[model samples]
Target chain A: MLKKMENNTGNFYIDVASIQKEKHANEICGDVFLTKKVSAEDRTIIVLSDGLGSGIKANILASVTASMAVNFTSMNAPLAHTAEIILSTLPVDRERKVGYSSFTIIDIEAGGTIHFVEYGNPEILYFRENETLELKKTPVTIKNRFRLKQPLFYSNCTGRRNDRIVVCSDGISQSGIGSRAYPFGWGIKNVNAYIRDEISRHPGISSFDLCRKLLANAIANDTFKAKDDITAGVVYLREARRLMVCSGPPYDENKDTMLARDLDRFAGTKIICGGTTANIIAREMHREICTNLSHTSFQLPPVSSMDNIDLITEGILTLGKAHRLLEEGFKPDLVSKDPAVMLCNHFLLHDEIVFVVGTKVNEAHQDPSLPVELEIRRNVIKKIARELEDNYLKTININYI
Target chain B: MTEITICSGTLCYIMGGADIFEIETKLSEMYNDKIRIKASTCLGFCEGENKQNPPCVMVGNELIPDATIEKIINHLKRLYTR
Candidate 1:
């Protein structure tokens, strides 16, 4: 599950993302990854569980363990109690003679405190400022009636901005098992080295992209065929990437300068959606709108460029099409040439999206003969903002001028 | 290089500038690198008396009102011949 949650810690945003690959020939991944944000509590919980074997049975075991881990942790249950519940719930394997599933639970509070618990899973790696930190873990043994004894490791730490917590299943650490290069396995040491090098090379890599790179490397270690279900989750605390979208013209013509001034003052990616809106900014800033003809799409109008503006496009039509694409859960990278897709991509990629919507109604669109789909500018922006917030978990702000 | 500016404003786009953007393929084959084409947001020409003419294009210093692909092509041809 790829979900990002914003922390109200004021200085940093908490981005949590995960990527998983099913074992070779398995219909479903035996590893289950889950994330949830409790808004009232201002807490985020991430769970990753790897089952005993590959295929559907293993998937069910992992799913049950992961879901229970997330719920228990969110409810502030004791670690031993959570482990007991999970162990009792899983069905025992006939051959192994044990109900088997390995899980890692990460509970992050609003004040930067992280509670990490692991049972039969690889240790989570904590990195800050290009160096990995050695986390102190306390081992606890849970003696329950159903099972003899289960060992769990608990670690509590406070994270700062630019810190990352990476958790993965045994499948990742055990990748390339029995292979000549890594006869033992691609152990945690190699994974740590790879992550360190990646952060050094790309200092600002997002948590989602880092997980993708790690997963790709792990898949390659197994000679392009994973021996078991692999899962990698990264929780990154960093400054938020913001994008401001200015659409339509301001309600009052005199306030056009105010729009331009706001856009100029914004210290983030800037996108102008409407022609008149772009013109207002261009004229006020004394910049030229250079239309990009190379990447023209028949479905949507071609995108344009201007000084200090990241993207410029035709307003209502492009926005409407972009809204539809976002609603469809379109991936912008696949067909990025379209103006609508480009807009949607910006909205998804950024941590926060701010829309500066102008309220002036264009007389041209008022014609009843025009397509009824030409909704009012504010309504379209509102729809897009809603989709972004609800589906993608993005922080959205719409200011109607 | 000859410059052609197409108005991508709302009125111009609805009037016919949408098809004018397609003239790039034809112009690239005809003029090669001799012409540069760009689009601007509302050239501010479609107001007052100029409101009667839309889908405006600027070919060099001359503004072609109610522009089309063919008209822009003809204007480009004339400019190249000169």
Candidate 2:
């Protein structure tokens, strides 16, 4: 069997997560964040940029800065040269240190080493276990006509389990402004204290959940209205946790015993999709299937549960909705308390995903007018697999039976 | 017009169910003009490792497991006659 996990060469797994606070309900987030996973070296490169002011102007500047940083890193250009070129082109403020658009470059490897580079934006917080890991800040000026005093920070730390590196824009620190509770704003001290408290309260918090918790608090501190456009990136290193999802049914009934045994022997979570597939597995394994007839998704049918199966749902429609959700974007609160949403969240949480697809087509789904054929259904699975790799940075393997 | 799709997936093709491919030339004279015969990577019906029903075919949305050429032709006749 081909290994579905990326832990073959590396001792650590990287969970890269980010969240952004938009200026308004309908406007694009001014703080642009980009993440690219280098397949050759298994390295994760992240760039966060906060443009001058907010709205479209800031969005454009931040987008340009973030993309340029990503492009430069992919080309293996010198960090200093890339920084110099980015600063020279942008209109820097005389009062601030190479100010116009601020950036933080984080290059993390699967082997537990952190290559952190920061300029203009707020300091990157390094955390190990629960407490903060402080690095000495040394000011290295970027040579320019205005004598730019950008802080050139370079630090390397070998990551262990539960090691986290957080980078954020000024918007996070500037939260709670104009509020009675915090006359100035939620400073770096408060943010650090909150993070430390959360870490201590709950161990093994995921990078995505941690980033989201901070963003949510920041927004709430401004009395349900964010004081500024905020952005946060939380990168974590740990061992990989693999998950197996068995969907559809095999082509022949004679193969049911092997399929049942495969599910029973799977070390990770086993999910059975489709009613007929679940029934076969249930019958073969002699396990009771408790189905929840509650309509979970508006478009898709409700979910079912078996004694051993982690999750069970109607096959194609649920997968379709899950694919759409991932494609549209990763928003935790999009469709709260739904089966498809729950499945998508589970998919995001796991590092590796194994899809066991059954090559059986359902007659109920076929209609002359509907165009729900075997080919269309198989295409849907392929589309879902592609979205998982592209959007979530997960290692996925598809086994067709 | 009727559409006849044969499952050519790993399980179906292996079960000798994909024999529809061999008889397409013979059926072309009798029903080729009235029906569309196509081979699909997976006709979506043989999911269980239980190859009890090795070959599968789809006429419209109806699945015919343990499908043979005669079974498929009869299914097509029934589908179109209705």
Candidate 3:
């Protein structure tokens, strides 16, 4: 998951994700994709660069080009100057005598304005509501002191909600170069058609999934062996997916009503983590919780169901286990009927997570006979929040009741 | 429908209620729609007179202490036959 640009002016949330596949038999990919969020300006810059060949030399070239493109773009350097610096900095190949690397730069501002610059790479594909958008591009020519004149394309447009911008290396556009399936290569036209079909089928497809699908198709076009380094970067503008998790019970019995009221007013998915916490909400809202014994996991207590709540589980233990799973880099395969796994899945699926933790201590957990791993509720919640923010790039907010 | 509520509180679970939960699948296969199984965070009975006999389970209106799969199944069979 990509870290979202905070304080976005437009209501739409920007999701940026990418995938890369190295050429067959190569230890490292020759294509490099870099994304940097300029928090001060509330802007994001993405750069994709593909070098001349495969292996170490190409990898270094692509990395240098991509890093320079990201830094120059973020610094607001003139388009021509940025191109000149990148072109002059690229080292010439001893055999070909040509310093070559294809690059695509995308700069998106807070108010939905986007500026794109492309050189040697395929033109970015823009989609709005499952339809291809035609962006007018101006050709730019840079003549530098090295007497090397390079042609670059510049385009700018405003982004709308549900709009998607996809940029790729030539490897994606030329996946099946010599294959009988695509005599001249996969081509941009076919790639655009595939994306259109994908959008029509799943209107709410995320940038990460879209990029993965695109890369998979590109590799298949090469008969499951990529001929060159392939990379796809997707920028999606859409409404954010939010989730609210209420754990533990408030310290003061008087504040129980307040917790329930806040939960009732939440606009997104809701979860209750503690038995006492769920009881408080059920009592205040006059609702019932029906536990599902069939989904019980040996390691954790069975999950329960409540009105208007997405999931209900045992607190401390589940949260502590979830924190450990995230720390070890949780994956889909690790998922089971375990409440901790379910909680981790919910945290991973949403873009924004709000944790409403109650400060009250559960007297039962303080018993000496109980396992020592039963950490304090507040401490466990804090650990989970930190893992989500630092590792998973999720937007997290904690409210102590 | 025979409603079976199993206590899944920390104390009950630790005392063998965890294994009793799997009876849902067994009861469903044997009796199907006749059994309605659910779990409760705490039946509030574990802290009282029957605290020593935990993993508690309630079948219909009858409360059974020290619940096991066979014991719960026997109770279910009796209820279904009635």
Q: What TM-score would you report for chain A in candidate 1?
A: 0.96
lDDT, residue A203, candidate 2: 72
Rank the models by TM-score, top first: 1, 3, 2
Q: What proportion of the true contacts does each candidate reproduce? A: 0.45, 0.00, 0.41
**DockQ-superior candidate, 2 or 3:** 3
Per-candidate DockQ values are: 0.46, 0.02, 0.40
Query: Which candidate number has the best DockQ?
Result: 1
**TM-score for each model:** 0.92, 0.73, 0.87
DockQ, Cα level, model 1: 0.46
Chain A fold similarity by TM-score, each prediction? 0.96, 0.84, 0.92
Q: List, residue by residue over A25-89, the lDDT tens digit for candidate 2.
A: 53878888998877777667899998887777678778888988888877778878888777777
Candidate 3, superposed: residue stretches over 4 Å from native: A1-9, A143-148, A332-336, B1-4, B14-16, B22-38, B45-56, B59-82
Regions of model 2 farther than 4 Å from truth: A1-10, A22-29, A92-99, A136-138, A177-180, A252-254, A296-299, A324-339, A360-377, B1-82
lDDT of 3 at A197: 97
Instruction: Give Cα-based local distance difference scores for all models.
Output: 0.85, 0.72, 0.86
Let me know the DockQ for model 3.
0.40
Model 1 ranges off by over 4 Å: A1-10, A144-146, A332-335, B27-35, B45-49, B61-66, B74-82
